[model samples]
Target: MYQYDAIDHQLVAERVAQFRDQTERFLNKELSEQEFLPLRLQNGLYVQRYAPMLRVAIPYGMLSSNQLRTLADISRRYDRGYGHFSTRQNLQFNWPKLEDVPDILAELAEVEMHAIQTSGNCIRNTTTDQYSGVIADEIVDPRPYCELIRQWSTFHPEYAFLPRKFKIAVNANENADRAATQVHDIGLHIKKNAAGEIGFKVIVGGGLGRTPMVGVTISDFIPRADLLTYLEAIVRVYNQHGRRDNKYKARIKILVKALGIDEFRLRVEEEWKHIKNNESTVPAAEFDRLQSFFTEPEYQTLTDNPSNLTEKLADSTGFSRWFERNTFPHKKAGYRIVTLTLKKAGQAPGDATAEQMEKAADLADKYSFNELRVSHEQNLVLADVQQDQLVDLWNDCKEAGFATPTLGLLTDMICCPGGDFCALANAKSIPIAEQIQAEFDNLDYLYDIGELDLNISGCMNACGHHHVGNIGILGVDKKGEEFYQVSIGGASGHDASIGKILGPSFAQEEISRVIRKLVDVYVSQRTAEEHFIDTYRRIGITQFKEAVYAKAN
Candidate 1:
């Protein structure tokens, strides 16, 4: 985790003070609702269905125990006793009093966290693989570059307010697209060329909303030093030409689509000519400066697989299942990346209570060198847990309701708080997530079904990332009633693809049955080695579609 330097502290403190004055003026009637709209949005405040929602940035999803505790404290003191973690690796406080926001901002400042650039037509959080440096066989650790992007994008005068909000994600892993780089305004696939020098394969115009499109690759490689200036060119083009007339069509993805990839590339390249190789180009000293902050945590010398680990697996099936689902490979021989999935039996997919957050902090301090990472999938990560203590950690996680053994499984779905919270949502997503979780509570059944991504979105904004889920459930409004639409064969990762909708939308109550029918079809027809997604891709949507819409004989 990157600790804030003096300059970082000064910049954030100044922003907080500025926002405090702005908030006070708005409350004093000097700033009307319309006047305060962009002002508050710049600070990550949103007027939700019932109340205001404040989004706090977790830059590149990295956190320290102290930061997590501060967040838990903020959640408890300022709003309700819980916070909703969004798919973008940010936290949302749904019930914060508008007056208390400045105070919340001050508190967050103390922990080196803030809500800046989290909302409103500006460069938002720059996210990356949650398992950044921890992954085994990694190509490169992306945290430094992500931090570089953070510095380059935050309150950038040139891109302070674009035609629409923008997002950037970085992924160094070749095997998975955990960062969903293909669906970001700009996706950086960090890799080394034949000479083993680092660079980025830049993908632009990838996004989902009213219009969904996978971003097109703009450059085969942007040299490591040229990333920043090249990025400037990309955003500069979008800012100058992207749709400003309609918010719905303002994202860079739409701009890329309208201009076509070829012309978009040409535009970016033409713009890059003047900007590239300028002062903005990252220098060797700058890389060294940022990389110093992400030094390796002190790790113990131990076997990759301990005898106790094997014994514990044999002793308890529950622990074994959790270990299989929640733990990921680590670069360290003795360490593992353990995720505390928030998808318990009844809770919303990513909702973490204050107590849960505090306990997670405690666990992080105890086992993970006091460090944590928030996954894009809306779960918490103890990225350096030792293999020897796997059973003890599992027990602690089970007690804390984090060991649901559903990571990358059917119930481990990515979901957004829909009509229940967001004013923009067409229907409630939390209840739909609840329905599916309840339907697949059986551990044997869930594990047997194999890995599946079941994502739910309240609307087309795709905050839940429904377009990439194996079974994407989208909430729709038909006539006067709330209906749900189902899409199949969607996937996220190296092989990213959008899902295809089956047919007419169904009533809310029928969603669980529809999901069940889809699952049944997959289970019946899938080969022993095939996962739900692989089956869907192989057998196609016809079988699942028939089962979902099949009439009873």
Candidate 2:
């Protein structure tokens, strides 16, 4: 993790002080709630259903042990002894008092973290592969580039007040764990050309809302040095033309739709003429400075040791199951990447208790370097765990409620804290997720149907990324009655596409059955080795739709 220098420290401290004053003014009745809306939102404070929720940004999902400890402390002191980890890899406290937020920001500043840019119509948190630096297939570490963007976008004078919120993602691997280069406002995929020049494949105009659109490629190759400049061009174009009349119609996707992708590309190209290589252009020295922050840790050189772990797995079925599902190949010779699952059966999808947070921090220090990563899937990552220690780590995690090994499976769902916490939600999402998990408790069945994304949102805001899930369940209100709308075949990776809705909504009681029927259809129709997505694409949603709804009719 990058240590904050004096300037970095001071910047956060100043922002905290400013927000403190603003919050005090609002509480004192010097400013109206309407007047304080943007300011509070910019600081990541939201007025939710029960109380104000304060979201704290964890840049690129990277964290130090100290930072994790800070989060644990914040949860213990300011919240209800827990914090909700969001799909964007941020943390939200659902019950923080409005007056306590500035104090929270000040505490976060001490650990080189903040809540700035976690919300409001500005460049939000930049997410990359949780395994970016440690993954074997990565082209290069994506965090340096993410850090560069973080610097360029933080309180950027021109982009501070955009027409709507904008999001960007960076992906360096073909695996797409970051879901980078997806349907973001701007997506960048890092690659090295045949000539050995590093550049990005730029995609623009992708988003998920009432209308979902996959981002279309706008530039084939944007050189590494000009990344910031190119990004500025994209945001500038959106800022200039994105609608302002209606908040719902102000996102870049609407602009992208109105202009057509070809024209949008041309317009961005025209705008790039003036800013392609200007002061905002990332200098080689600056890149070097940022890269220094993300240099690989001193890793021990060890011979391949797959024997003991293989033998252990062959003996203990429980260990074998966990090892197969929770581990990924690490870049180092004898290391592995491990995900600490927070989605145990019946737990809220991303809520980590203070004890769990502390335990995670302690384990990160013991098993890996004192470095940890919060994944966009709302889980924690131990990026450099040794292969030999996998069982030991798993045991510890199991004891601490961190070892479920259900990554990318049916139970590893992405769900928003809907009606219970969010003021905008029309229905409850956490219970739906819980019901689905209970219905699909068979681990072997889940592993058989691999790599399926299940996302749920209480409303059309798509916070759960329902539009991009292989199975998207959206909550809707029909005359004050809670109903769930199901969608199928959505993807958020390289070939990002939004799911199509299946007929009418179902009553809350029917949601789990509908999901079961949809899964059953996929299971019955899939060819050999076909995943849920592969089967869905081949058979389309019609068969699954009929299977789920026909019985009800």
Candidate 3:
């Protein structure tokens, strides 16, 4: 995690003071709601269906134990006793009182946190691979570059109000893209040239929400020095040429679709000539300074699978299952990346209670070098844990209800708050997610299903990233009734592709049955050890579609 310097601290504190005044003036009736609309949004305040919701930015999803404790305290005091971790890797408090939001902001500022630019039509949080530096195959640490983008884009006057909200994500790993870069407005895939110089393969005009698109590569590789200038050129072209009359078609993706990537690239290249080698170019010293913050944590020199690890795995099936499902190989020896699943029975997906947060913070302090990462999949990551402590950590997590051993399984679905909290949702998402989770509760069944990404969005907004799920479920409002539209064969990684819709929508009640049918189609036909996505691709959508609709009929 990047420690907040004096500048960072001052900036957040000042923003909090500014928003406090704005919020107070609005409440006094001196400022109208229309007048305060953008102001509030810029501070990450949203008037949800039921109550005000506040999104606090966790830049690149990095959080310290102290910060986590603060968030837990805030959840307990200002809002409900839990917070929803969104797909963007930010935490959302769904039930915060509008009047108390400024105080919330003030409290957050005390801990080097704020909600500035989390909302509004600016470049939102620049997300990246949750396992960036820790992942062995990653080309370089992307978090430093992510922080660079954060410093460059935050309160950028030029982009504060684009045609629509814009998002940028960077991925450093060449083997797999855990960051879902292909779906971002500007997806920066870091690569090295023949001479071993780091650069980016820039992908532009990709997003989900109404119009889902896979980003087209605009530049195969641009030097690291020109990153910000190139990024500015792209955003500048979008700001000037992007649609403003209709927000639905205002995204850069729509513009690129209209102009074609070729024409868009031509214009971006034309615009880049003037500002390409200006002050925006990253200074070597500055880059080094940012990189300095993300140095590897001190690790004890221990052997892999240290004392009792294999013995415990052999002894306890639960431990073995968790070891397989919840843990990942760390870049360092004797360390493992443990993901704590937030999806469990009877609770809404992506939500962590205040007590859970505090417990997680404590666990982070003990196990993960006082650092925790919030995954894009809405789970918590302890990036560095000694191999020997695996069982102890597993037991602690299991007691806390985050040890479901279903990281990439069907029950470990990514779901939005949907109609439960969000005003724009077409139908309820939590219930359906719960329903699917309950149906797939059996560990044996889940393990058999194998490596499925199930994502649910309450609407076309695609907050849950429904388009990229191996099995995607989207809520559609059909003549005032709630229904679900299912899709198959979508993925976010190397073979990034949007899911193809199955057939006509099904009622909420039939969702579990529908999912079961899809699962059956895969299970009955899959070759040995094939993942659900591979099976879907091998069999094609025809079989799954046939089975789902045939059973429905």
Candidate 4:
């Protein structure tokens, strides 16, 4: 929501122009594929299995209705008539031509958006709770600080080329919508201490791959003002000492593991002594300037429950079903947080059509305050919708193919666009997701399963955050055959932890049955009030593995 200032605008324009020239040179043969790799990556371009792919940044997953409309336009005009929203809350175009990238970026700049840092070994997009300002439980809105990191990390000269890609997340809410701050390269949970001073409880080096590890807490409290300074120290230490010889071993998680958390903390503290409150730390004036961008939208006064809509829903079970599942609490009275369900049973998860996109934009304009957000779970949010208009909104959404009542259910899956699109993927993920959805078509069963985040990725890049789902599935290719791997005990929000691998990979045909077994294990092990994640953590993955893997073997 931060509007670009003159300097911000100019900087982006210049970057666009620079990328345009770089793209032109690459297309003209002035730059080879190898030569253009890093340049294009810094601009969020990737040469995928088919054509080139471009990822556009939706910083912290917040977008205005104008931005959404712009995205729809870009998808229509630039590539195919659609774009893939990625797990990191960014958008990806699978068929972008190298020659057209510059123009694409120029268009994005006009909307105060860019592709910078969406990829590459440099600091990638700084993510935060999508419901930051609107969520009732938040101690403080984390976007201002996120924007501060955006400024400090953007094209930072010294840290521009790190050994591996880095990710950072900020979660201010106790519920941990941003995940438990667990598998990110760095996670920041913004909180106020007993003294009522704001600071971050920093987690470092948790990631998933061939070697997966939970991030260790490095600092109990990093004073709010010195957040950037402390972050710089962490990255600098990683940049200087993280394994550079082997690309596979280059993430901060590896460095933290090798040095051990105690020594890593000590080293970071020593480094922080010099940089703790340097120029990079966000000053008070800039913080206020950024905060102004997220001012609350105007709303009309109304009752908590509207009689008319309640009466209508009272008659129709269908309408009530959707209202119950898709709606969440909003900070404002008479306003509710509406999640537009992207999961239609048997459909590829999180795939929205162009018409669906437009309908969302229109709804954002008509009912919400011309603002929309994309959740990490790959769903869209109309953060503030009036209670009176809920039924009408649901009807319109239903007509537009946007009304599905599967929020936080098994159907509401987090998935990466796997082998169908991403070259890095080892197997196709969408079809597997469809198969699982088909197997568990009973809504009551899924709802009874209760708030399970089932995530899948084609490979270990963990794009779907397969590492943190209640049921995490990773697709692996064994020899010439495609196989799916299972992990359990993963979670993203409030109590984030990377899932443990269940055992060996399964043939693609066995995936659905494996999932069924995992679910049955949960049903048997869980108590009255425990969610899937709570049950998984309480009992551990051993029993689940015994149920699913032991039989398969």
Question: Which ten residues in a row are the worst by lDDT in model 2?
Answer: 174-183
- What is candidate 4's lDDT per residue for 281-400, written digit by digit as tens? 766787788889888888788788889777977898778888889988888889888888778875567776666678789999988898888888888889889999998899888887
lDDT of 3 at 152: 96
Worst 10 residues of 4 by lDDT: 174-183
Q: Where in model 4 is the C-alpha error above 4 Å?
A: 540-543, 549-553
**Clash pairs of candidate 3?**
none
RMSD of each: 1.0, 1.3, 1.0, 1.8
lDDT score for residue 133 of model 3: 86
Off by over 4 Å in 1: none
* Worst 10-residue lDDT window, candidate 1: 488-497
Residue-wise lDDT of candidate 1 within 189-307, one digit each (tens)? 99899999999999998888778788889998888999999999999999999998999989999888889999999999999999888889998999999999998888888778899
Regarding TM-score, does 1 or 4 come out ahead? 1
In angstroms, give how far residue 237 of model 4 lies from its true place.
Answer: 1.1
What TM-score would you give candidate 4 relative to the actual structure? Answer: 0.96
lDDT of 4 at 254: 90
| Backbone clashes (count) for model 2 | 0
| lDDT, each prediction | 0.91, 0.88, 0.92, 0.85
